[model samples]
Target: MDIVNALALFANFVAVPATAYGAQLALGALGVTLIFGILRFANFSHGELMSFGAMATILVTWTLQDLGIGIAPFPTALLALPVGILASIAVSLATNRMVFRFYQRRRANPIVFAIVSVGVMFVMAGLIRIIIGPDDQSFADGERFLITAFEFQKATGLKEGIAIKQTQVITVVVALVVVAALFWFLRKTRAGKAMRAFSDEEDLALLSGVNPDRVVQIAWIITATLACIAGTLYGLDKTYKPFIFLQILLPIFAATIVGGIGQPVGAILGGFVIAYSEVMVTYAFKKVITYLSPTDWAPEGLVQLLSTDYKFAVSFIILVAVLLIRPTGIIRGKVI
Candidate 1:
């Protein structure tokens, strides 16, 4: 029973939360990978795009709530998601037409495009900040816990109890559904094939009668949809803050690079790897250790590898190591 308690404790603090976070990161990384794989540039504005989407969702959720609308057991944000996605798509299209397309037409270098994206990042960031203000906004509604610790303890009769959040389950479920749909679309759809062909060889795809403009439009639209879903889910799971997205960008990039840039499967794998690493490294193991130890013994220290505040540093270290040792990542994906 002590062993069971230990496992329960570990799951409560580390496993469940990490899994949800991993799913969120995977979605964000997929958007980044898609843009890079197709457009051939690192988009520095992706984080701000996420912020904008989440901001839009939050605003719409607030409006819906004021209008006495809700889904109850689920967040109202779900109902507002479509509106947010549309807003994000509009901004993304406008950005492509007004900013990125200019560079594309001029045949700018990838580095130039990356720098331009940074400029766009600042602009989006400022806009989001102006709209949402620089503070954490809580918009989550409906059920908070799928399984509370007390309920779990009563059911299992274990000293340690696991608590699971509804948002965590939703994040994982939605991410799986979205990823499945994306993979299917890529494998079976016409536009997906065109996008893949364009990514592989632009000239060849054009000669094969693929429409570059349509492909580019589709990529941005898909990316915006992904960013909105990921952002809204993340905000629901955690809290919506204008600055958190910027901080999250590092881990998203790390996940993309570690999994192998341009490899969707790699992005998913890398997200979990990075999530588990950050969680396990920072998590205090004293409780689990105490539960597993002999009857009267206990450790004095927290037995944590690092503090929670340094979690992002773990991603950075892993990213650097991967870049130095295996630039192509775990799956030998395209080198950036």
Candidate 2:
């Protein structure tokens, strides 16, 4: 019974939150990986792209709420997600056409493109701040928890009960669906094959009659979809803040590099790894340890490796370690 309680406590604090967070990170990393693989540049503006999507969704959600509209069991943001995705796609396409097109035509080096993307990141960040302000936006609505701690305790007769949020479950389910669809598209669709071929060998793919412009468009569209979905889901789970997205870019980049930048599966795997590391490092395990211990004595300390405020440092440490130990990443992706 004590062991079970300990497990329940662990699940409540570490597993569930980490799983949801990992799903969000995976989605964001997928977009980063796709851009790197297809566009041959590290898009520093990807985080701002996420912010832009969430901002759009939040605005739509506010409009709907003002009109007395809601989905009850689900967040109204779900209804606004399509609009957010469309907005993100439009911005992505516009940026590509106006800024990146000239560089592409000039055959600019990847580093130059990366630098340009940093500039774009600042521009998009400014735009998002101008539109949404720098305050946290609470757009989440509908059901709050799938199972509250009290409910779980009453049902299971356990001292430690798991509390599962509705958003956590929804985030996981949506991530699975999106990832499956993306993989299928890449594996079974004609355009997906062309994109893959282009990533593998640009000159050869062009010679094989693959339309470069069409491929680039598809890549941007897919990237925008992934980024928008990820941002909205994350905001639903937490609070939406324009500046937070910029900070989140670190973990996303870390996940991308740790998972192998060009490998989708690696990105997903790395997301889970990074998420678990952050949660576990910051979580206080004193209660779980005391429950599992045979004696009644408890540890004086919190038994946390690090404070929650420094959680992002875990990702940074892991990222630096991966770069030093395995530059190609766990799945042996392309070197940065």
Total residue pair clashes for candidate 1? 0
lDDT of 1: 0.92
Across 87-144, the per-residue lDDT of candidate 1 in tens digits comes to 9999999999999988876778889999999999999988998888999999999999
Which segments of candidate 2 are over 4 A away from where they belong? none
lDDT by residue (241-291, candidate 2, tens digit) is 988888999999999999998888999998899999999999999999999
In angstroms, how far off is 201's CA in candidate 2? 1.7
lDDT of each: 0.92, 0.93
Runs in model 1 deviating more than 4 A are none
